[model samples]
Target: MQTPTPSPGQAVLAQVLAMLQPLVVWLLRSGVGYTELTAALKPVFLEAARAELARIGGKQTDSAVSLLSGVHRKDVRAFGQTARAVDVRAQLGKPTPASQVMTRWLASDWPDSLPFSGLERSFEALARAVSKDMHPRALLLELVRLGVVLEEEGQVRLCRQAFVPNPSLEESRRLLAGSVADHIEAGVHNLSASDGKTYLEQSVFADGLSPASVQQLEQLANSLWRDVLAAMVQAAVPLCEQDEPAGGNQRIRLGMFCLSAPMELNAPNNNPPDGDGDAPHAKDTR
Candidate 1:
């Protein structure tokens, strides 16, 4: 059997479909319908068209956007005039009950590792201090769910220094949109670069590893990623603490991730280890 060579357009279309499969799968699992996806993509498609025109130094008008975006001119105008829909859940930033509880636990004066009940400086007292309207028990349960605190022997202990409230539906939706958008934007920017200059978009990948080797690789990668995370977080903390001077609104996001999985299941492994099986894998500090 032979596979026929596809035309350039056919090849690109196939690539797009292949790349979109995982996202579609996620959307389906998340209970988002195709119609909902289409609605969300409209503004994104329009924005993409606007970006393309700007890249080429072309004028971007409602009609031009409609033509480039394949959207009706009226719809395009409406999208431009309308305020972007905001996710109400995302606005409840850091000062949430979970963060307050964790921050209070980290305070120098607080020191009670045992299960706290009616003590003067107990878990309930601390939760009550920061939780405001929420009950102490409710705050404690939420904290446990978020992995921010642990309860044992009638006392609660802080597990994580940072507060990451359990991501609700809207939080997950926002993260889905933001992270994938940035990732695709990086890829697109690199693809459209004609001057041989590029951003720091890179990944290390390889196949043909045994399960043992894969485990070793994962550990090595985890160590390297942890070091990078620590350095970046340390650098970011000072910036967060500094006073915000009056200026135009500007924000930045730094994202890094690591993935390791079998590329194909049931693939034959021909290569075997030559050295001691316990030999350490090469470490990458970066």
Candidate 2:
């Protein structure tokens, strides 16, 4: 007997289900159920449908949007114009002052310790360089409060190489949303593009790894990310300054992630390594 092939929509839905697993886990853990999710998604679906229709030079009437998005015509027509006019990205809020200082510290060639006040190579100078709107002392206090740094005898000592706010905090939640939203947006853009433009969204996947090997691979990923982060920041700073004076109409995000999980017992086995010891099966999304 031969296996039956799925239709295009069925195949896409299958992949979408796989992609939604992690998000569903998050939603359930946060006490959001299917009803709440569907309610929240109504406006989003209409907005996305309108955008798609505009992109393809189709009519953006309520009926057209409803047909494209599978949303009811009444709901599409009822979507408040005022709400639709608001910029969604602006609602995420800007990065905190402490995170800004932390990023510059990690990316720059500055020393681990700097005096509170000085004209050159000081904590005050670094903070002001990032933003003149915020006082350096206030930024230092914020970082200290977050346990990211320590102030000793007028010198601020770096407590860690990276800064991560408490997960339960609102700041961390917003940050996560912003990052994940951009990642999904990139993938959506690539999927819908007709002109061949694409963003770099590749990942390498391998299965059947021991726990120890997975841990080692995670460490390697972190090490590699540190190098990439520093290099990208160094290359981007001058360009950003140059662009800001010319209106700064664009932005960029470079991210890296790693996940390891045990394979299901009933799942098909991945192909073993060839004679050359190279794994024969690896998933690469480009």
Candidate 3:
């Protein structure tokens, strides 16, 4: 006995059903409602199947063919089951009645009771606390003395110009030594203490460099600060925010976050040009 071949119309119907099966499964898994799934899929598949029937020289008026014009029958049944399961859990996850999600968030250790507090405030408070041996309150006083902290609406903040330094001539000399060593390694042997001071003066006096370069340097500095600050804030802020706390690990995460990038990318490279007029290759800073 020979197996019977399916008609062109039957073959088109089978292809349409196969194409729609995965979409049906996705809708069920995504928790679409049974009524909604049926309503949405019926119109889409019916039109597609009708077009398929027309292409295969079949009559749309035939009842047997029209029955296959809707979404896959097996998917319709599975959608009902999946929708029921999701609906049962909808109330539990819904944000309407003050969700348990907040409860879980509050239960976990964040900086304070108000979970939606501004991140800047948390960061400023953490920076102040990490700076000195005193309490957060006392550190604020010290910061004010150093002309870095400011008061606004009873809240403390770091001043905008706090990142700038007024390094004395002596301290500048010491800092320049290390910077010179770095330049030497990069084949920029001409840099001296005078050259470092000249660069610093240019940076200080000029109407600021290009915004793109400044923004790039600021972002890089902030990124490095964030890594160090995050660990310090996690260990320190909770203790400070608490009314009373033990005193054990109380040290500033050693560097100032407000300072500018230690190395200036905008500064002209002073290295001697190679025979080909290309810049000398430098060792990786990292």
Candidate 4:
């Protein structure tokens, strides 16, 4: 006897589970159990159903949503009665005043170290250029807190070329969530696209590499990204300014990620292990 091929939905579910493994690990670390996750998922399912219905020009009645979402009609009705939360994309994608200031400084090719306040080429001028609504002092404090800049003797210096936040900070988790969400959204859109359009979703995969090779590749990738980042920022700033007066509603995020791990993790064993496997663990460089 031979096993039958799984249906498309079943096959996709398996793939999704594989992709979700890291998320599950994070959830466990954060103490979010099954019950909490399930409870949170109900609202998300309902929202997705509503969006799908709108996309297909279908009537968005409670029964229709329930039928599509597998959520109970009562729950759907209750959900509709409550105010919807702010869109996650908006919350995640909108850069802070501090971020805008940092981007401006980086793109302008200004000195990395600038006086906090002065007549010419000061940090305050950069912050004020990004937005006058927020005081420069407040923005500086935020940048310092995120470990992106340093302040000593009234001079502010860029500490990191990139806005890499400390992993322990809440702001770091928020950024991680935003980047992961956009990356997955692009992948999903490519998979389901019906108009022959596709987002850029591609990667290079390799194995059987020694640790030294991995390290060398990692350095190469970082150098490549820095060049790409500077070019994109320089090109994008003027285009954004041109679009703003025209009431543009679009935003874009370009990102790259690299992961290298022990080959065993990539190729899981079919049989259960009585103890942890023999693979050496790799420290997370991110």
Candidate 5:
């Protein structure tokens, strides 16, 4: 018997698995076991099944949900029953202590550098201002370890200009899951949308750049995004405080990220001539 050719759906599923494998690894490292993952996944499947079935004008019965989700009917009902509690828990991310300190630090004004021992407007004061519960010394040590602050001459100075103080793998995965999911949501909406207006998805791509130039590009992107984020926070604060009319309030995720990866040898490559009529091989893929 001849082997069947791969379909487009198979290709898409393969790509999704490729993307999901890393997230699964991160989840495993973060102490989410396979059982926990399966339990967590059941709710997601039930939700998607219900939505799709409803969109198709079908009754969202337990059996129907089970059929659509490929989960047992009892499991589907259990997922639906537990969805509210899960949502409430999801709303509260249980932010790490270190992240809370960083958020509060960036919210307030501080000197470029401050002496650690000063009674007023000192590093200790700043840390206390961020969190009275955590010891200032502990906060200082954490900040230094995370490379968010520089310690020298009995003074501590801010290092990172953005919210990513710790830059831990777990934190990265958290952001990755959220932001990428939101992006995919927008993309899916646009896929079937009648109007041509698209979500704010854009990127700059270039290949054959020197390592120095890539570093320069990274710096440029970081600087611009920092300014943009500051402006967003400053401008959005008052607007966010205003009471909503009848329509209700809105939540948003306006974010910018900088990513760079070396081109892979096995990856597909297409050479396009630059303005100066040079066909340099490019390796970067977005």
Candidate 6:
């Protein structure tokens, strides 16, 4: 009775499925309604469907070719074009015209500090580019429904800023803390510790945890910390991407100390006779 091993493709698919499963579960737990879920799942499901269709078609499977054979030919084609447009914009290091228009409106002189009216026009333009028959208002509404946008003082704006490419140390620590808070709020109570050191120890060195679980948690923490550092650097220092690494490393190390000191002091191993006198006290003035 030997267990059969999965092929490389199957192994990759399994990891993807595992990652996606938690997200799906979280969505269901958050009380997302059927209609909202359907709309949200549309792009993902369609992409998977198209991939599967091509897989079945052997080497001759072009998504563009297979898309035209389907009833929703126009939609598939439009999606492909929009994806290309987004890629080109990213490569050019500039926002799409719609993004620029929206940003200008955000920075404009509306009676309210936030500009919702301008966002509506930008959303319309974005929707039109996606599908000629698609209603911009509906698309915007859908985004709102999905909790990706917020309405304030008659102005619609992003619920959160886009990811910053690289971050400073202080920013990294803040982001990591924020991510921990978010996870706790979302019922991932396992990692909730009074201090950063305890949290890291529990997350990293806890007994009986699987290697896979440890790896996943480490990756999540690293990603969250990186995002925080990047945002802080962008806001406070605005360094070029090439100039970010040293600052980012310095900040992250500082953040680790800020978070870990309290936990280390509280641990049973504290006040060991062999401890180095030169080591900085947790409360020592910098």
**Which lDDT tens digits does candidate 2 get at residues 140-235?**
999888788899999999986445447677777787777777787788779977788999887888765777987998989988987897898888
Q: List the residue pairs that clash in candidate 4.
A: none
Lowest lDDT 10-residue stretch of candidate 1: 85-94
- Clash count, one per candidate: 4, 0, 0, 0, 0, 10
After superposing candidate 4 on the true structure, give the runs of residues whose Cα lies further than 4 Å from its correct spot: 81-86, 106-108, 161-163, 265-286
Residues 7-77 of candidate 1: C-alpha lDDT, one tens digit per residue: 98798779888979988997788799899998888887887788778988978889888898888898898
Q: Write the per-residue lDDT of candidate 3 for residues 100-188, one digit (tens) a residue.
A: 12222223344332212256435333533344343545544544565655656655544544534445433333333344333332332
* Candidate 6 structure quality by residue, lDDT tens digits, 119-176: 6455454446444565656656655654546666565666545323223433333444
Task: List model 4 lDDT by residue over 104-188, tens digit each.
Answer: 7766667889999975799998888777898999999998877789999999999765565566876567767888888888889
TM-scores, in order shown?
Answer: 0.61, 0.86, 0.26, 0.85, 0.64, 0.27
Two-way TM-score contest, 2 vs 6, winner: 2
| Model 2, position 218: C-alpha lDDT score | 92
Give candidate 6 regions above 4 Å deviation.
Answer: 33-205, 208-286
lDDT of 5: 0.68
> Given candidate 6, what's the lDDT at residue 102?
36
Question: Considering TM-score, where higher is better, how would the candidates rank from best to worst?
Answer: 2, 4, 5, 1, 6, 3
The CA lDDT at 139 in model 1 is 84
For model 5, the superposed segments whose C-alpha errors exceed 4 Å read 1-8, 31-36, 77-80, 83-111, 114-157, 161-176, 192-197, 244-248, 266-286
True-structure lDDT of candidate 2: 0.79
Angstrom error at residue 164, model 1: 11
Alpha-carbon deviation at 94 in model 1, angstroms: 9.8
Lowest-sum lDDT 10-residue window in model 5: 84-93
lDDT value for model 3: 0.44
The model with the greater TM-score, 2 or 3, is: 2
